[model samples]
Target: MSGPLSSLRVLDFSTLLPGPYATMLLADMGAEVLRIEAPDRVDLTKVMPPFDGTFSTAFSYLTRGKETLSLNLKEDGAADRIKELVKDYDVVVEQFRPGVMDRLGIGYETLKAINPALIYCSITGYGQTGPYRDRAGHDINYLSIAGVSSHCGRADSGPPPMGIEIADVAGGSHHAVMGILAAVIQRQQTGEGQFVDISMTDAAFALNAMSGAACLAGGIEQKPETGLLNGGSFYDYYQTRDDRWLSVGSLEPQFSARLCDTLGLSEMKGLALSQKPADQNALKEAIAGKVREKDLAEWQSIFAEQDACVEPVLTISEAAEHPQLKARGMVIEVDRGDGELQRQLGCPIRFV
Candidate 1:
C-alpha cells in the first residue's frame, strides 16, 4: 500500500541535517520529495567519510526515496525553474539564513504569489525576524543560546558536546515537519497555505519542557546533577563490573522497591524517593557500589524478568543488534539509488 502522505509533494531546499531529515521523514511516508542542491556548492554530507562504495552512507540514507536536482540559484532562469516546480509542489522546505531566499528571488512571498497554496517552511538557527537572524550558528550554538547546554552536562565539565545534533534534528527538523503538516491541515480547511518559521534556538528553548515550566512558574532553576531526571536522584546510569553501563530509571515506589530488593538494598529503598541532597547522594553511591559488583551481562540476566526500569547502555552498533529493536523492525534497508540496499533506521511511526 502507498504511505499516508502519498498525495504530498515536497521541494526540499535544505542541506546537511535538519531540512534533509524533515524531507526524509516525509519521503518515508510516501511523499514525493525533490531535493534541490547547488551545482557548485558542496554539501558536507556528500563528502563525509564511511562511503558505501560510491555514495556517502549518511548522504545515501538522508536522500533515500527522494529525487535530486542540481541548480545554480544565482544563475539566470533558476528562479523561473523553481517557480515552475512550486506550481505543482505542495510544500517547500528551505534552510537558508534570514533574507537569503529573498535575495535569490525565491522567498516565501515571491513563491506565495505564484502558488497561493504553497506551504513554505524555513528552518533557521535564530528565525527570520530575530536580531540574530543574519548571524550564523550551529547546533551547539543554538543549544547554548536556548539554555539547553547549560544544564545538560556535568558541573565540572560544563556542557559536553552532544553525540547527536539535538538542536538541529529535534528542534529544527521536527518542528519544521510538524509546522508543515499543521499548515497542510490548515490549507485543507482554508485552501490557503502559510509560512512556517522554524528557529532551532526557539524550538530548543521550548525543549526545556518541565525545567522551563518550573523556572518560569516556580522560580526554580535546574542545574547539572540537580534535577531528578538530570542526575540528582539515584535514577541514573551506573557502571558495571566490566565497565559497561546500565541506566536505572526505577522512579516509582514499586519499581524502586523491586530495584532495591534485587540489589540487596531493600533497607535503603526509601532513600531513593528522598529529595535531600545528602540522602540522594548516599543512595546513588550505594546503588553505584552494588551495580559495580556485577558485570553488564550478569545484570542483564538478573533483570531479564524484573519489572524495574533497568536496561543496559548499548553502543550504536549494539543497539542496532538488540532484540527489541530487531523485533520492532527498527532497522531497514533502503535502496541507494543503484539498486544497492543500505541499512538505515526505519521510521518509528506505525500505522495499522
Candidate 2:
C-alpha cells in the first residue's frame, strides 16, 4: 500500500545530514522530495571515508527516492525560479543560517507571499532573531551550547565530545520532520502557511529533558556515569568472558532483585543498592563477576529465561542481521546497481 504522504511535494534546499535525513523520512513516507544541490558543490558523502565504490553509503541511505536538481541560488533569476517552484510545493526545508535566505530574496516571507499555504521551515544552530543567530556552529557546538553534552560521558573523565551528532540528527532532522508534520496539520485546519524556526540549540535542550528535569528539582546534577541511567551498577554495560558486552537495565528494585537472583546472588535481596553508593558499588562488582563468567550468548540465553531487562550488546553488523531486527524489517536491501544490493537501515515507522 502507498504511504500517507504520497500526495505531498517537498522541496529540500538543505545539504548534509540533518536536512537530508528529514527529507529522506518524508520520501520514505511517499512524499515527492526534490533535493536541490549546487552544481559546484561536491557531495560531502563522497569526500567522507568508507565509500562502497558505487556511491557514498551515507548518500545512498539519506537521498533515497528523491530527485536531485542543480541550481545556483546566487544567480539573478534563481530566487525567482525557486519562488515559482515553491507555489506548488507543500513544504520547503532549508538549513541556512538566519538571514541567509532573506538575503537571497527567497525567505519564508517572500515565499509565503507567493504561496500562502507553504510550510516553510528554516533550521539552524541558533534560532532566528537570537543573539547567536548568525554565529557559525555545528552539531557538537550546538549540543555543547545547549548543555546536552554536559550530562554525557564519564564523571571523572574530561568533558569529551559525544560520538554521535545528536544535535544534527535528533535536534535538527527529527525536529524538522516533526515541525513540518505539525505545520501540515495546522495548515489543513487554518489554510495558512507558517514559518517554522527550528533551532538546533533549542532542540538539543529539548533532547535533554530528563536531565533538565533532574537539574530543576535540585537533585543530582546529571553527572556522567554516576546517574541512574548512565553506567551505574544497576544499569550499565559489563564485559563478558569473551570480551563481548552485555547491557543491564534493571533499574527498579524489583528488576534488580530479579537480576541478582538470576545471578545466584540472593544476599543482595534486602539491600537497597540503588540508594546507597557503597551498596551500589558492591552490586556492580558482583554483577561484573557474574557477567564475566560467561560469554555474551550465554548471558543472552540466561536473560531470556527471566525478565531482568538484560541484553547482549551487538555490533552494527550483528544488529542488522539479528533475528528480531530481520523479522521486524528494520534492515532492508536496496539495489545499488551492477548486480549488487546494499543493506540499508529501514524506516522505523510501521504504518497501519
Candidate 3:
C-alpha cells in the first residue's frame, strides 16, 4: 500500500488468471485489494504444481499484496455484505459469466446504487453482449475467434500452441486494467461510476493492430510467414548447432548489413531487404545454414558485442539469470507473511 494507487481499494471477485492478474497489477501499484472467494470452491491456481509451501507459487505471486475473504456469495446475506462493502471500496472486478453476478444480486447496477462513484469492471471471453457472450472459452479459443491465430505460426504447421496465455493476459487482464483505470478517471471528472465491459476476444481482435488495419482499410490480407515482422524476412528464429535458437531481427539496412557481415554472408545483404518471397526465402535459408554452423554459446560469444539485434532465445530459467533482466529487477523476493521470502516475478512498470 505504498505506490501511486495507494488511495484506491478494490474488491476482487475474480478467480483465475485474467481477473487476478489485473488486480495483481493494481495491488503491486499500492491498491488495497480484497479477494472474495467462496468457501466451497477451489481456485485452480491454489492447486497447480510447483508449490513453495502449501499454496502454488503462482497463487502466491498473483495474490501478492492482497487480502482474502472467504465469503460464500450464495449465502443469505452475501449480497448484503457486498453492498455494505461497496460503500467503502472504490472498485469491483469480476470474471464470472455475463449474468452470473446479476443472479448473485451483486451486479454493477445493484452496487452502483449504493455507491455511485464505484467503478465496476467485468472481464469475460466474448463480452456482455453478442452471440458468444455466454459461451465458455480459454485463451486459444479467443485467439482463434479473434483471427490472431490465422496469421501467426508456420502456414504448413498452422498456429503453434503458445507457451504463454496471450488472450487471457494480453487481452482480458490488460484490457480490464485499462478499462477500469479509464472509468476511474471518468469518475473523477463526473463524480459517477460506470460499468467497464472487457472481452478477451474483442481485445485480441484489436491486437491485430497494424495487420488489422492493412486487412480492413488497405484491403490486403496478412498471412503467416508473409508479413515484414512475422517471419517473412530473415527476421525470425534460427536454430543453432546446439539445438538452441537465436532470434534475428536485422530488418533495417544498417543492422542487416552488420548481421550479414558477421555471418560471413555479406553478399546476401540485399536479399535481406527484399520483400519478394523467393529472395527472402533464399536469405533466410542462407542465414539459417550459416547460423547452424555454430553452437549457441559460440554465436553468443561472436555476437556478444554486436548491435545487430541478434540474440539467443533463452529458456525461462536462462532468462531469469540473464544480466539485462537481473539489472532491470524483473525477479524479486516477496514476503510470505511467515518471515520467509518467496522469489517472484516483479512488476514491470517503473514509476519514476
Candidate 4:
C-alpha cells in the first residue's frame, strides 16, 4: 500500500541536515519531494564523507525516495518558473536566512500569493524576526545558546562531546515536521495554508524543559553535572574494565535495590537518589569499582536477566547490528541510487 502521505507534494529548498531530514520523513511516508538546489551552490551535504560514487552516504540517507532539480534562483525568469511550480506543490520548505528568500523573489508572501493554500515552512538558526535571525549558526552553536550544552558533560569537564547533531536533527527537523503536519491539519479546516517558522535555537532551548523548570519555577539555574538526569544522581554511565562503557539507569527504588544487590553494594541502595555530593560520589565510586571489576560484555551479560537498566554502550556499527535493535527492525537497507544498497536507521514510527 502507498504510504500515508502519498498524496502530498513537497518542494524542498533547504539543504544540509535539518530541512533535508524533515523532507526525508515526508518522503518516507510517500510524499513526493522535489529537492530544489542551485547548480553552483549545491547542498553542502552532497560532499560529506563516505561517498557512493560521488553521492555522499549522509546525503543519500537524507534524500532517499526524493527527486532533485538544480535551478539557479538568480537566473533570468527563474522566479517566474518557481512561481508557476509552486502552483502545484502542496508544501514548501526552505532554510535560508530571514530575507534571502524574499530577495530571491520566492518568499512566503510571494508564494502564498501564487498558491494561497500552500503550506510554507522556514527552518532557521535564530528565526525570522530575531536579532540573530541573519546570523549564521550551526548545531553546536544552537545547543550552546539554548542552554542545552551548559547542562551537559561531567562536573569538572565542559559539555560532553556528542557523536551526532542533536540540535539539527531533534530541534530543527522534528519541530519542522511537527509544524508542517500541524499546519496541514489546520489547512484542512480553513482551506488556507500557514507559515511555520522553526528556529533551531528555539527548539533546542525547549529541550531545557527538565532543567529549565529548576530555573523558571524558582530561579534555580542548573549547574553542570548537578540535576538528577544531568549526571547528578547515581544514574550515569560507567567505564568497564575493557575500556568500553555501560549505561547505568537504576533510577527506581526497586531497580536501585536490584542493582546494588547484584553489585554486592547493598549500602548504595539508600544513596541512589542522593543530592549530597559526598554521598553521590561515594555511591558512584562503589558502582564504578564494581563496574571496573568486569568487562562491558560481562557486565551486560550479568544484567541480561536482571531488572536494572544496565547495558553496554555500543559503537555506531555495533548499534547498527545489535540483535535487540535488529529484532525491532530499526535498521533497514535502502538503495544508494547506484545499484548498491546501504543500511541506515529506519523510521521509528509505525502505523499499526
Candidate 5:
C-alpha cells in the first residue's frame, strides 16, 4: 500500500548513520528521498566492514529505497544546482557542525530565503547555538555529556559503553525525524517553513529523563543493575540450565507474587526485602538460583501459562525468524541488484 508521505520529496545531504537512518524511515513510508553524496569523498560505506565484498551491508540497509546523487558542492555551478533542487523539495536534512553549513553558503537561512515553505532540519552534537556548539563530538561523546553514561553498566564495573550508537540513531536520527514531521504539521497551519535545530546532547538527555528523575528525587545515586527498571531480583535476566537466557519483569507486587508462585516458590510469596545492599544481593541470588533450574524453553512455557511478564531473550537472527515478527512483517527483504537480497529491520508503524 502507498504511504502517507508518498508525495513528500526529501533532499538528504547528511551522511553516516543518523541522517541516513532518519531518511530511510521516510523512504520506507514512500517518501522520495534523494541522497546527496560528495563526488570526491569516498563513501565511508566502502571503508566500514561487514561488507558483502562489493558493498557495505550497513549502507545497503540504510539506503535501500533512496536515490543516490553525487555532487561536489565546492565545484563551480554545483552549489547552484543544489539550490535549484532545494527550491522544489519539501524537506531538507543535514548533519554538520554549527557553522559548517553557513560557511558553505547553503545553511537553512540561505535556503529558506529561496524556498519559503521548506522544512529545513539540522542535526548536530550540541546544537546550532551553545557554549559547546563549535566542539567536535560523536555518539559516545554526546551520551557522556548528557549524563546517560552515568547510569549504565554494573556498579562494580565502570559505566560500560553501549554496544550500539545510541546517541547517533536514537538521539540524532529519531529526533530529526520527529522535528521534521512537526515542522510539516506546523507549515500546514502557518503557511511558512521553519528551521529545526536538533542537538544530539539534548536528545540524549530527553531519552535519559527517567534516570534523571530518579536522581532528582534524591533516589539512591542509581548504581547500575540496582534501579527499579534495571535489574533487581524481581526484574532481571536469568541463565537457564541449557545456557539460554530468560528475562523476567515482575516488578509490581501482584506480578512478583505470580512469578514466585509459577516457580513453586510459595514460601517466598509476599516477600518483602529491604533495598539495602546486602538484602538486595541475597534476594537477587535466590531468584537467580531458581531460574537456572530449567532450559529457556521450559521457562517460556511456564511463563506462558502465567501473567508473570517473562520472556526468553532471542538473538538478532532468531528474532528475525520468530513467528510473531514474521506475522507482523517486522523483518523485510529488499532486492539490491545482481540477484542479491538484503534483509533489514522493517517499518515499525502499522496504519490500521
Candidate 6:
C-alpha cells in the first residue's frame, strides 16, 4: 500500500464484485479502503467455493490489504456516525439499486452536503437514472443488454454465458477505477468532488469498441464467431490430440504467416480474416487438422521459438504459475487473515 494513491481514503459499501474489486485496485495502489459490511446479512462472496475450512478463498483473497467494519446502517445513530466518518474519507464507493442509499440517508447528495470534496462512485448494472437502473441484474444481463453477448461464443451454438464475469470485471470494476481516478484528478484541479455514475451496461458497451467500430464503419452487425479476434478465422481455439485446447491468436499478418508455415497451411497466411465465411472456415479447419494431429505438449515444443500468440488453455492454477504472469509479478503470496502466507492475485499496475 505504497503507490500513487497512498494519501487517499476510500469508504466502500459495495458487496460483490464491482465495487469491491474497484476499491481493491485502489487499495493495491495504496488507498486506505474501509469496507463497511452490513451486520445482519452475510456477504454472499464469503460463502462461495474453494474454501479453506469454511473460509471463502475468493472473499479472503479479494479482501486482502483492506479493513472491514460491520455496522447496522438501519440502527438509529449508525447513519449519523457514518456521515461523521465520511467527513475524512476522500472517496466513497457504493453498489446499491437507485435510491437505496438515499433511503438510508447516505446518498451522494447527503454525503456531499457534509464533504463537498468527496468523490462518490456508484457502481450498478444500468446506472442511477436509466429505466433499468432499479432492475436486478448480474454480469450476464449487463452483457446481454450491451450487445456483447451477441458477439460471444460460437455462431452455431449461439451466445453462451462467458466463463468469467467479464462484464463485472471489465465493465464495472475497471470502469469504476478509471472514473474514480479521473474524478480524483478533476477534484485536484477544481477543488470539488462530483458523482461517478458507473453503469455495467454502459461499460460493457464501451468494451464493444472492436465490434462496434466495425459495425459502425461497415454498417453491418457482428455475428458470433465472425470478428477477427472473436473466433472468426484461424485465430481461435483448436483441439489437440490429447483433448487439450490451444488458443491460436495469430492475427497479425506476420504471425499468421508464421503460423501457416508452422502448420503447412501457407495459403492461409494472408487470409487471416477473409470476408468469405467458407474460405475462413476452410482455413480454420485446415489449421485445426494440423493442430489435432499433435498433442498439446508436442505442439508446445514445436512452437517454442515462435512469436505467435498461441498457447494452451490453462486452468486457474496453471495460469497463476504461468511464466508470463510470474515474470510480471502478477501472482503473489499474501496473508489473508490466517496469519499464514497464502497465494493470491498480485498488483498488475507497476509504478515504474
**Which residue pairs show backbone clashes in model 6?**
none
Backbone Cα, N, C clashes tallied per candidate: 0, 0, 0, 0, 0, 0
Give the per-residue lDDT digits (tens) of candidate 5, residues 181-208: 9999999999899999999999998887
TM-score of each: 0.98, 0.94, 0.98, 0.97, 0.93, 0.96
- Candidate 5: worst-modelled 10 consecutive residues by lDDT: 269-278
**Global CA lDDT of candidate 3, please?**
0.93
lDDT of each: 0.93, 0.85, 0.93, 0.90, 0.83, 0.88
TM-score winner between 4 and 5, please give it: 4
Task: Report lDDT (Cα) of residue 51, candidate 1.
Answer: 97
lDDT of 1 by residue, 65-108 (tens): 89999999999999999999999999999998888999999999
lDDT of 3 by residue, 1-352 (tens): 7999999999999998999999999999999999998899999999999888768998999999999999999999999999999999999999999999999999988999999999999999999999999999999999999999999999789998899999999999989989988998888899999999999999999999999999999998988999998887788999999999999998889999999999999998889878899999999999999999999999999999999999999988899999999999999999876778998998998998
Candidates 1 and 6 compared: the better one by TM-score is: 1
Clashing pairs for predicted structure model 2, backbone only: none
lDDT of 2: 0.85
Runs off by more than 4 Å, candidate 3: none
Worst 10 residues of 6 by lDDT: 267-276
Candidate 6 Cα outliers beyond 4 Å, as residue runs: 267-274
**Candidate 2, residues 1-352: lDDT per residue as tens digits?**
1589998899999888888999999999999999988887786864676776477888888878788888988988999899889989999999888888889999888899999999999888898986898899988889889887776767788467766788998899899999999999999999997989889899999887877888878675777766777665467889999999999888777887898889989898655354776777788888889899999988888888788788999989999988999999999887665467888999998887
Question: Which is the better candidate, 2 or 3, if ranked by TM-score?
Answer: 3
Q: What is the Cα-based lDDT of residue 207 in candidate 2?
A: 86
lDDT of 6 by residue, 199-314 (tens): 99999998989789888897878987877778876678999999999999887778888888998888766567566778888888888899999999999888889988788888
Candidate 6 Cα lDDT to native:
0.88
TM-score of 2: 0.94
